[model samples]
Target: MTKPQKAIIIGAGPAGLAAALRLQQYNHISSVVYEIRPKPTTLGGAIGIPSNGLRLLHRLGLYDNIRLRAAETSNLVLHAIKGDVIGKADLTSWSRDKTGFGYLRIQRTSLMDVFYDAARLADIPIHFGKRLVGIVENSDGVTATFDDNTSDTADFLLGCDGIHSAVRKLYVDPNMTPEYSGVVNIFSLLETIMLPQARLSLDGLNATLTTDGLLALCPCTATNEMIYWFFSRQLSMPPGGGGRDGWEEKGKQEVENLKVTLLELLKDTSGEWGDMWKAIINQTNVVKFYPIFRMVLGGQWARGRCLILGDAAHAMQPHASQGVSMALEDVFLLSKLLEIPGRSLEEVYAVYEQKRRPRTDRMSKMAERNGNVRKKTGPWQLWLQECAISGMMSVYNLCRLDRLGIGQKELAYDVEEEEV
Candidate 1:
């Protein structure tokens, strides 16, 4: 009997967990996940699973379970900050017919829970509080060192450690760093009771565009009992603003200041929308702030037996809402490559990077462009955005662009019988 290949996955996020599950489907591979967090914590926001991502999860037989806790949306409603409807795009049947699944919005914590449960059932070991500190690779395998003064050896190492990946820093390329997008996002969750009027006004994923920035409110539950919202604005960094280590710590220290800034922005909005925004702000128990950052795509993804996937490989702006989807797609592709017989680890990593880079790079550029358009703050820019959105919605409706599922095609992956 052939010995099973040992794979070490860094980070227990969607990508890492999904990769572990996918590897389990193959008899030749055994994997474990290491998470830096001491325990599972609420991700505190919502994430959208587009048709492509939903379809992948469905194939893994986990979609039905997740669907029970998620909200399905049929359209995205664009509204002006003053409360006028700007445009709409149908996503229900159109997405299902095109990609074999509908779009879903669910709490990030819920999604992680589903993945975690599935991993547990599959008998995958996920070690918490294991912070990766260093990696050493040899011709036969790789050794991963954790901060706890322990080490693990595996035939391969996969980095799904997110945008601030330790694997990427210690192994792949130290010079590659995430670049700030000049926008800061403030996010909060509001219960339906807290913002009853806003809940009544939102029919689907609703967004408002203004000179200040974009405010998007997305329903997080099927019953519309809770809402997840975010306010993004172009913020100029103050001198010594983020400190030496960046905004992670600064964000915590300036929560009140951030709230004040957001409240002022809301005050500028008029009518019921303004009221809704204010209600959301007042009802929010905590307000979290983070600056958006994008990683430069198309660089080395692997060295020796170690490779990086997902945000570790191609972190992009969230405007396209493809971050998680792209990460899942990476898992699907990499798993397939790993199943190939007689291929060296280095060869598999090379092929994976060669095949995945172009697509991820393209998506990264598209996401950056989308972010730019959404972050417009001038009167002329806002007018142009309105016209562009209207035109795009018309084209989407007329040509049934949603049905095409253009960007989702390459993302679709089918596991082979032998791999399963």
Candidate 2:
């Protein structure tokens, strides 16, 4: 009998967890996941899990449990800067279709908890506080050293450790670094209030382009108690002034400083819309700023037996909102590719990149274009673009590009690498 393969995944976030869950299905393989954050704490903001993300979760046996904890939105609303409704995207019919199961707007922590629980149920071991600091790879396997002075070796290593991935550092050209776009994205959470007019004006999960920046608000969870807000503008000060650039440990003072510009841009809004901002600023204890940056796909995703996925491989603007979904897609696709035989790990890794890179690259460019459109300042240009988007969305709720594979056949990722 062939010996069981062993794998180690760094980072227990959604991407890492999904990979773990898929690997768990192969009884012969022993897989372990390492996370930096311990239990009882979670990562940032409201994540809109479109039908694709939900589908992956469902396939992994986590759909029902997660759905029970999240809020489902039937429609997407578009608004003007002054709190006026420009368009309403009805998703009721789409939500009911086989492909369009709508979207679940859930707290990031809640989603992580569910994934963690599901992984536990599957007997997958996830070690917390194991921050990956270094990676060593050879033709035969890979070894990861964590901050806790622990190390593990596996037949293969998947670096789902996020943007500042240690694995990527080893292979990517040092000159082609991730450049910041000079925009600081401030994400805030607020107590959900029932103000149909305000909600419609801001466009719940439907992005809205305004004069100053892009403001997006979406429902989170089922209780109507929490909502997610994102506000962005060109940064006059450096990212997290006088502090490190990482968003994970940003200070409240910096967030407060950014809120000043946000408040000015939102000055015209009134009634419940204004109140929502006030509540968000006053009540929220947690906030984060992502200095938008884009990474060019330079290095091959895998070096020897070490591989990278998700933002670690392709960090792009969030305008596409596919960061998580794309990562989810990676888990399934990579799992299939790893199941393949005859070919070497490098060959399988190359195939995985060939099949996935084009799609992600296209989406990254689209997101950059979307950001440009949102940042358009000239009156005529902004109006024409918004009207065009509104018109397009009016007829078809799903973006044309998204519809092609929306909940359809899972991208036929290769399987010989993992097949027994």
Candidate 3:
């Protein structure tokens, strides 16, 4: 078989777009992206791009643009519910000379803008309002059919769609479904002024650990203290919740109701000074509830020139905060594998899976552990958690181990320079 060139990329997300760009840049593979939404995703309020993700973005010539739009967060400050500082992972001396980046926080919309603009500048075509419904693969090529009843043929197809991937459902793993992790995250963006009048510094990524759960506030925009606040709580999906985020009018109303419920639930945390946590929630006009989901990712990543990447391949919890970084790692490694001369899609898929799956599996376990530690707990467990966080942060800071979020052993793996 000839080397696969023309590619069909499903989902214009960070992984998909980055895959397309990398494929074009390194392997000279041309691609067309199909996204279900009319425009970029508003999935969450903001995200933190670690060094691993940033390095890949830099290789794609997209680093500068994203850097300009995001805020640099050097400290992950841990705090108790009563507003006492416990510890912090100072990323200042995190060996920037090695990883070439620290931690960056940016709004989801801004990051999407960078990707979309970059795709446009690179002359890649992204077809919006197209939902994939069917896929057919033959010796000659693979064809992707959308809900519109139209189809496009390519040398191969990639399911960069998402966790709930149509490519995975229709073509790859038809019987599989996203398993609810019994954890839900409530998140929103806010101005610094919106916070209750408290003598607290908003310079670092502030994480408040309550007896119930965890709440985090990170500076997002580069110029100001526009905070991207999110909290984790144990909540069940209503047999089939998470239909969508609170975007539409009906969904917005549902979030508003959840907001009121959350206020009641967190009433115990209110103090004589004021309900600081409740005030932040009450002032937030746009609140979103996202239930964490995970996919069992032990099987094949490809079948007959069709493969999956990013969340479509392995969806984990958010405690690790490495979702986008891992997705970018997937994009980087896959494209690098494809660059090997005269390699068929099958060989490329094999090599890609061999090198990628173990890493993702390890990450999945790490995320689970992180989530468990951050869960709501009793006083003894909470005290243990506080000690654990402080101790770990102290270690990280003393060794300047923040060489990247997670450091040299993981974040330092630069696939661009590694042998493919």
Candidate 4:
């Protein structure tokens, strides 16, 4: 009798948990997930699980639970800062018929809860507070050492540790680091009652483009009572600032200053829009700020038996909204590759990179371009943005681009059958 290969997954986010579930379904492999956090907690704002991600969750039997807790977003509305409706992309029936799932927006906490529950039901052992200190990989397997000096050995290691991955530093490339994208984001969650008038206007996902930034308001719950809103602006770091660390250390003060700035910027918007921004500011109890960063496109995804996925491998701007979906796709591809018989771990790793890199690179470049468009700094650029958005809207309405496979290629991936 052959022993089942053991896999070690770092980080318990969507990618890691999904990987565990898929691997457990295979007869030849078993997995355990190690999360640094003591418990599952909300890390950031709401997330949009697009068709690609939703389809995979559906396969895992988690779609129904998440759907019940989240809002099914059917349309994306684009508006000018002055509150004039510029365009819209309707994705109601198109998503269902084309991709087998609809885009869902929910709080990060809600999503994590579902993943956690699913992991538990699958009997996957998740060790909390296991902060990775170092990883050593050889021909036979990989060993991970944690902060407490404990270690675990497994047939392979998957780094889902996110953008600041310690695994990447130890194994992949020591020189590679995240580059700041010259944009700062401030965001918060507000109750609908606080913005009563604004609630009346939010029939769907709403976004406004300004000369210096973009503001988006998305419903986070099915009842439409809680709203997730964010502002991303082109801001340069002050001289001698420590970048991300500095932002974190001074988060409170910076958030307050950002709130004031956001209120001032909202004044540029026409009537209800301006009032809505003010209401969101006044009603929020806590505000968070972070400087956006992106990894350089195209890197070695695997070194020996250790592999990195999700934000750890290809972090991108939020503009494309493919971050989570891309992460889900990575694990799906990996799970499929691992199921093939007579393949060495290295061979599987190589094929995974070959299949995933192109798609992720394309999305990263598109996200960068989208960020640039949103950061329009001049009248000419703003005018160009309006024209481009309007044209795309016209094309989308006529052709139903979402249904025409605009972002469905990743979603349509077929999972391999379980070994009988």
Task: Tell me the TM-score of each prediction against the true structure.
Answer: 0.90, 0.82, 0.89, 0.90
Native-structure RMSD, model 1: 3.1
Candidate 4 residue 293 Cα shift, in angstroms, is 1.4
lDDT of 1 by residue, 1-420 (tens): 123378999999988988899888854478989999998775578888877788888877789988888887657888765566778876555556656777788888898999999998999999999999999987677899999999999988999999999999999988788888777777877787877554675766888887777888888887778788987777666457555465766566557675576676555566777777777777777877878888976567898888898999899988777888888778888878776677777777778777777778887887787677546477677778788888888787788775666544433433222132
lDDT of each: 0.78, 0.69, 0.78, 0.79
Q: How close is candidate 1 to the true structure, as a TM-score?
A: 0.90
Model 2 regions more than 4 Å off: 1-4, 26-28, 38-41, 91-100, 137-140, 147-149, 171-176, 193-203, 236-254, 257-260, 270-286, 376-388, 391-420
Top-TM-score candidate index: 4
lDDT of each residue in 268-387, candidate 4, tens digit only: 677676677777778887877878889987667898888999999999988767788888778878887776677877788888887788788988987887787656466567767877
By lDDT, is 1 or 2 better? 1
Give the lowest summed-lDDT range of ten residues in model 3. Answer: 245-254
Candidate 4 accuracy as TM-score: 0.90
- Candidate 3 ranges with C-alpha deviation above 4 Å: 196-200, 239-279, 395-408
Worst 10 residues of 4 by lDDT: 411-420
lDDT string for model 2 (1-420, tens) is 123288898878788888888877743567898877776365578777666667677788888888887777646777655555567754434334544456778888888899888888889888987877777777667788888898998888888877777667755323445666556677877766633445534434644566767777777877556778887655554455434644444435557676676677667666565666655656666677666777775656777777788888887787656678788777788777665566677777788888788778876886686666545375566677678867876556446433543422332222233333
Model 2: lDDT to the true structure: 0.69
